[model samples]
Target: MIVNSDLTMGEGVIERHEVETFLTLAEELHFGRTAATLHVSTARVSQTIRKLERRVGVPLFNRTSRHVSLTTVGRQLHHELRPAWDDLRAAVQRAIETGRGLSGALHVAFVSPAAAQLLAGVTQVFHEHAPDCEVRIREAQADQILPRIRSGEIDLGLTTLPLDDPDLTHGPVLVREARMLAVPAGHPFARRASVLTADLTRVPLVRLPGHTDIPPRQAGAPPATTAPTAGTFQEALTLVGTGQGALPAGAHARRYYARPDIAYLPISDAPALEWALVWPADRHTARVRAFVEAADTLIHGHGTTRQPPQ
Candidate 1:
């Protein structure tokens, strides 16, 4: 018959290490090996098991110097504990795998140019691997993208820098792209390898209305002329095609809207424009994970030109 002991109840009676030792030994069923696994000597494993038995008021194991096996009580304990431990292990593994890569949807938002240029390849790769996952892309301005991300209206965003908010996580997806001077085919600059920014200073310049702040050059190219302003890429493109003035655009824009009448010349000396990928700090869902992975893989496969800025 088992007897209860008052000494076992007060405060510091059952040591957690003793319980852990029992479970570990039970798993291995070998004193010396269990001891080695636990980084302790067999003597210590024996002492710990004895302590646990006394505290539990039951024999947990049938033991002999040659072999150790579970007693009736030990078998009961194993039956009860095994499933719980298995569950814990499964949960931990799931968490790690989810952290690595798993099934989910990812919503992406981008500015007009980025939407047109970068998202297609990214979506294609993501869908190929995660066929069940869904991707939604929205086009908005820098100001509009962040608010939606903050409000949980979007999962990820691509935009230009100067994001000072601490609630958002952002990384450079592409470095400043050299601005290309886009003109009509008959334009003189179209025949040249590249055009100087200074050459446009006195020329009629078609500019994005609200984006006057955007730098006017390709890498270190000369400065270009500016008309008062035009809003949106479509507006700027339209004005340039009509020969109103030259428009400065990123490399992607030049290729996306390649027109028979329009010609794009590289700017010789302008500061590049920065492109970045951003997401909210607190948003973590399977879909978001899928999107981030797809974006990463797409960026990687594209080689240097498509590589995200470090």
Candidate 2:
């Protein structure tokens, strides 16, 4: 129970359940929906709301045969209580986690072989730091990273940047590797010492599903056209090998995804590809922070290489 100085007597107190029920009902505006959301019966919801109204000394809602609307007082209360409730819940959760000493499950996902290897290192260090916490790691395709994070299926993602989404938070850059162009072994570009960004105009670039930052072609070159979209990095590399298109890949691919049919040529003028950890902006918990700290400790303190081993 919490005391509300804004209440009628400046001494009104309400149970935690009562606050939850009231807030849920206020948003739903329907007893049935509120009950379903709260996993309680409609009778229980009604009883709770009535008790809250009595305590507040006002009819907080207007109800007729077919409609439910919050009164002026109710609207003001909801406006003020929502943020306060969120803060209270967050505080309690932090308290519980601190008391328990970081001993629960944390789900993390990574895209690409390079990311997987880096995550492996980070996980080892994290386990050493928080041995009681169970770390679950999964591999996801490039396109599946954001959706899984948003849906709460994964607590963190290690993937390519720049992720401009405001809904997600990016961790410190863990790997920065030179950009390379992947082409068929017999392709002209494959035999060159290096390639240029303008060379992208000569052939269709194999497109990754969610990538929008295709290298810009040189001036006076024809505008780039739509290319085949690949769901995974392997598929993109396969497209490159089939002579359908070239792929812009990180230097790490040359080491991890070596293929006889494919050749990786460094892009002389292209900026390095950066890999980082990402998670939902609102879901940054102690476990997530701890894992990020582990990455910092590994890379900055232990002299972890910025690029995958050759």
TM-score of each: 0.52, 0.68
**Clashes per model (N, Cα, C within 3 A):** 16, 0
lDDT of 1 by residue, 1-310 (tens): 1112212323446444565577788989999888988788989999999877876788998888688899988988778866765565677666654555545545688876545457777788778877876677778763477888888777788776656788888654644566677786788887899976677675678766334225434556556556645667777777788778877777666657777778888777766666667787766555565666676666655665463211
- Estimate every model's Cα lDDT from 0 to 1: 0.69, 0.82
Top-scoring candidate (lDDT): 2
lDDT of 2 at 183: 87
Q: Locate the minimum summed-lDDT window of 10 residues in model 2.
A: 1-10
What's model 2's overall lDDT? 0.82
* True lDDT of residue 300, candidate 1: 57
lDDT of 2 by residue, 1-310 (tens): 3333232324677777788888998999999999998889999998998988988889889998798999999999899988988887777766667444567888899877777888889999999878999989898877788999999999898887888789999888887888888889999887799987877777788889865335546668786545698888888888888888888877878899999999988888877777788999987787888999999888878676476654
